[model samples]
Target: MKMLLLRYSTAFICAVFIITGAVSGEDKAVGQTVSFRPDKIVTPVSSIIWKHRSSTGSVVKAIEWDVDDGDNIPNPRFKGITTLDQKTGEITITKLTVEHSGVYTIDINSKEHEQRFTLNVMERVPKPEITIEESSNPDVVYLRCAYSEKIIWKKSSGETLNGMKNQDPGEFITVKNTRNPENFYTCTLKNAVSEEISDPVTERELFGTGEDKAVGQTVSFRPDKIVPPVSSIIWKHRSSTGSVIKVIEWDAEDGDNIPNPRFKGITTLDEKTGEITITKLTVEHSGVYTIDINGKEHEQRFTLTVMERVSKPKMTIEVSSNPDVVYLRCAYSEKIIWKNSSGETLEGKKNHELGEFITVENTGNPENFYTCTLKNAVSEEISDPVSEREIFRTGEDKAVGQTVSFRPDKIVTPVSSIIWKHRSSTGSVVKAIEWDVDDGDNIPNPRFKGITTLDRKTGQITITNLIIEHSGVYTIDINSKEQEQRFTLTVMERVPKPKMTIEVSSNPDVAYLRCAYNEMIIWKNSSGETLNGTKNHDPGEYIMVKNTRNPENFYTCTLKNAVSEEISDPVTEREIFGTGSNAGMIVAIVIVVFIVIAVIAIVLSYLIMKTVHESVNNICPCIPNIFGPLDCLLKKTDREPKNSAPNDVASPLNETAP
Candidate 1:
C-alpha cells in the first residue's frame, strides 16, 4: 500500500510540471520584447542602462547596444529614433524630445514585439541669432550664423555652410562673405535627440554709384569711406542693357587687372596701383567701364568727338587789246584784290564772288604788272604777277583779200571781241562790211563795191566781179590797234575766139574726119569729099566706107574761114581695122561682094513678081490692067517680035516693040 501511494503522488506532480511547460512554450511562440532607451542625453560618467525583456517565460540571452548623437550623425541632424540592432530589437537616440518620443518594435522571426516610450532627455541648445556687419559697405559685408551651443550653418537652398565653434562676437561666418540679396541662410543647433532652429540671416549689399564718360576722359573712383583692413576690392562694368560686360578683379594689396575688348592691346592696367590708361584714344573705344569692389558693381560711360581741315585757292588772268572795245577777264575762287605794279588798285565789276567764278573788264595796261590777290577770311593769297610787257605786242595780223587772223597764246573763257578798221585811197577810215564771221570778219572800205566772200571759221577771203574803178590800195586792220596790210587791185579786158582747123579722110574706105573750134565739133567729113561739112549743116554726108575686114588710110580735114574763105588742111591717119597688109583691099572686096549679092537678090525678086503678075493675068483675062507691062509681055508669045517690048526697057526687044 505504501508503494501504491508513492506512485500516485509522483504522477500528479509530473502532470503539473507538464502543464506549466506547455503554457511556457506557447508564450514563447506568441510574445516578444524590444529593448530601447528612454532618454539619450546625459552628463559624462552618468548611469547608462542596458534594459531588455522577453514576452515568453523562456530565458532570453542579453545583447549590448550602440549609441550615436548629433556629433556622429551626417549633416543636418534631427531629433528622431534609430534602431541600434539590425533586427530593430534595440534603439539609442540623442537629444530626446517630444519629436523623439515614439513606439519602437523588435522583430523575432515573423513575430513583432513593441514598446512605447516617452524620451525625457534635456532640451537642445538654442539656436544663436545671426547678424550682418558692414551690411551697407559696397566692397564687402559680414554675415554671422550663431547659436547657444555648437550649431551647423546651412543655406536654405541646401548648400553646406562652413561653421566655426565659439566664433568672436562680430566674426563673419563665411571666409569671403560676398553678400547676395537672394541667398537664404539658416542655423541649426542639435543635442541628443533634441534640435533647435534659428531664423535666416541675410547680408544687405550696397550698390556702388555708376557714371559714364568719353573714352579719353580721366576717370577716378574712390569709396565714400575707407574700409577697415581694406578687403578685396574688385571693379566690374555693366552694359547699357544691364548685362555684365567685364569683371574687375583686384587684390587689396596687389591692386587690379582689368581687361576690356575695346581696349585690347591698346590699354594697360597697373596691378600694384589700380590705375588704367588708354593711349591713342579712338571713337570706337567708347563704352561703359565698370569697377567691382568686393563683388559690388559700379559703372561709367564714355563718349568721343572729332573735326576737319581746309584747302588752298587758285587764280587765272586773261588780257586783251583794243581796251575800249574788248574786255579783260580775271577768274578766282576766293576774294580777289587787284593791284597794278605801280602800287595802284584797279577797280571793276565784282561779277561773281561765291567761290564759283569772277570776271573783270577794261583793266588796260601798257607796262605795268597786274597782281591779283585772292583773300579769304582766314588767309590772303596772291596770284603770280602778270606783266604788261607780255601784252605790249598784240598777237594778231591782217591782210587785204587775204583773211585777217588773230590767235591767242592761251585759250581763255568768255572770248574777247575783235575790232577791225579799213582805210580808203583818201586815207579815211570807212565802214564797208563791219560784220563778225567765224575765225575772221569782213570790214571792207566804203568805196569798194566788189563782191567779197569771207570764211570766218577758216579766215579766208575771196573777192569777185571787181571793176576798174574799184581798184585801189586797200588796208585792213585787226583789233583796231594792230597794224594794217595794203593790197593793190587791177582789172583786165575780155577774151578772144580761139583758132581751129578741120580734119578729113584721105582714103574713102576708112573712118570719117571732123574739126572742133574751141572744143566744139564745127565741121565733119568722110573720105576725100566734103558735102556741106559745116556747123550750118547737121548730119552732113560725104563719101564714106565702112572697113568690114581691115582699115588703113589717111584723112585730111580742110577748114574754111567764115570771112576769108581760106581753107586749112589738117590730116589724120586712119587706124587700121586689123593687123594685115591688105586690110583696105579686103574691106573694099567685102563691100563690093555684099552689094553684088544684094543686087542679084533684088533682080530675082523682081522677076518673081513679074511672073506672078503674068500668071494672075492669064488666070483672069477679064480683070482690067491686072498685069500692066509685065503681063503684056507674058501675053506676047514667041510669035511676037522681040522689038515689040516696052520702050522704057532699054533692050533690043524694047526697040523692036510695035
Candidate 2:
C-alpha cells in the first residue's frame, strides 16, 4: 500500500492542495487517505519515529523505523491502517475515521522536528435545496436554505458574494432583484471539513405574472354575493406553482383569523362585504387570490403579478428632409400614444408598433402641436408639447457667388400670383421675387433685380449670383395665401481645394503633414477609413510611418464647411518622409558592418591558432597531436618509453588512472 501511494504521491498532494488550499492543517472527509510528509530535514538519520497527539494533549507513539532493523507500530490502533516508509520517513494513513483527527509529528533520530501537522476528519456535507418566498415586486424576493452552518451564496455568472444573513435562522435570505433573470443562483452549506452546493434557482422560476401591480401598492378581492349577516368569509391564495395557502378567514362567531404569517399585519377582511384588502404588497404576495363567502366558494378569482414601477420616458424628434415629414419618437418600447393640443388621441398616426414613433406630416399649420405619452401598468408620463414650426423649418447653406432655388414644399400649378419674401438677420422683411398671372416676374430690391426670377406656374423662386447679404429666412406665398413651411438659408465663402504640405520631423519614423486650410480637416487613407493622428498647431498632424505597418497607403485630408468641402491631393508616407531611400541605405550599412566584423573575427582566430602552434612546437617537437593544444602537451609527457615497458604494459597497476 505504501508503494502504491508513492507511485501517485505527486498527484495526491496536488489534489489535496486544490481541494483544501494545502494548509499546514488540512481538512478531509471520512473514509479518505491522508499522507503526512516530513517537511523538515529527514536525511542522515539512523532511525525515524512518528507520534500522534490528541486534542486533549495525550500523545502516543504511532510508528518507529530503524535503518538497519525493520519497522514496528507501537499503537495497535494504527497497526493495519498506517504505513511508514523506512527510507523516506513518510507516513500514510488510509480509511480515516473521525477518531483519527489530531496533531501529528515526526522525530528524526531522537529529537522531534519542527514540522507538525493537524488533521480534521469529518463527515461529508449533505446537499442542500433552496426554498423561495415570493414578493409582490419582482425586484425583491426571499430565498431560503435549511443548513445552520456557514452559508455561501453564488451566482451562475461566477460572481462571488459576501456572506449573507438569514432572516429566519438558516431559513430565509432576502434577495433584491439584480435585473438579470437569466443568471441562476445557488447556496452552499460549508463547514470546517466539507461543503455542498444546492441546485440553482432563477427569477423566472420563482415569479410568474398575470395582473401586474407595483410594490407598496394595495389590491382588493371581493365576493359580495352572500346575503347580509354572512356567516364566514375566507380568502385563499394559490401560488403559480399550485401551492394553496389561506390568506384570511373570518367566522361570525370566531372573529377573523389570518393563518399565514406572510399576510398577518397587512391583510384585512370585511365581514359584511366579504372583501379582502392586502396593502404594502411585496413580491411574495403575488398569486391567485380567491374568496369564499358564507361557506360558498366563488368561481371568480384574481391573479396578481407584482413588478417594478415604470420609468418616465422622454420624447425625441427626427425630421426627414426629402419627404418633409416629422417623426415624434418616445424613448420607450411599449404603451405609447400621441395626443394633439386639444388632448385628442391621434389614432392611425402611429408609424409602426415595433418602433414607438409616430409620423406628423408637414401640414404647414403652426398650431400643429403634439405630445407623446408613455405608460405602463403602474405609471404614465406625457412629454412636453412639440410645435410644427420646430419640425417643418428647412435650413439650407449656400456658398457666395452661387445660384440657389427656393421651392415650396408642394407645387401649386396655375397660380394667380406668387411672392417670395426674405427676413434678414436684422428682422427686416422684403419681397425678393414677385409674379402675377397678368404680369411677368419682377424683383423689388435692386440687389436682387437682375439676379431673382419667379416661376409663374409653380410658384418657385430662383436667386442667382448669391452673396453673403442674401442669408436670411425666405417665405413663399401662392394665390394670395402664405405657406407655413419656410426656408432658412446661410451664405458663406466656399472652401478652397486644400494643398497638402509635408515636413519630416526629427524622429525618422514620423512625419508632420499640414492641409494649409483653416476649416476642419479629416485625414483618410486610400480605403477612405478615417485616421486619428496626433494633432499639431501649425504643421497640422503628426502621423507614424513605421508603426502604421502600411506605410505605402496614400492619405488625403478633407477640408469641410457647412456650404462646401474639398480634399487635398493624396500622398504616401514614403514620399513625405523619404523612408524608402533611408531604409535601403540602412540595410546596406548593416550588411557592410557585418562583413567587416566577420573578416576581423576570422583574422583574430587565425592569429590565436598560429601562436598556440608555435608554442607547442617549441615546447616539444616530437608530439604529433594537433587536434587541440592541450592534447598535444599531455601526449608528450605520457608517451611510452621505447627502451623498456613490456612488463609494465601487462601489469594492471601500470594503467593510467582515468
Question: What do the candidate models score in CA lDDT, each in turn?
Answer: 0.42, 0.75
lDDT of 1 by residue, 55-174 (tens): 332222222233332112221223233334433334554433332222233333333323233223344465566666564534454566544455677875466677654545322454
Instruction: Please give, for residues 428-476, the per-residue lDDT of candidate 2 as tens digits.
Output: 9999988877887778888788888876666667888999999999998
Q: Best by lDDT, which number?
A: 2
Q: How high is each candidate's TM-score?
A: 0.17, 0.42
The reply for model 2, stretches above 4 Å from the true place, is 1-206, 214-248, 252-373, 377-392, 399-403, 407-419, 425-429, 435-441, 455-459, 476-484, 492-494, 533-536, 539-551, 562-564, 579-658
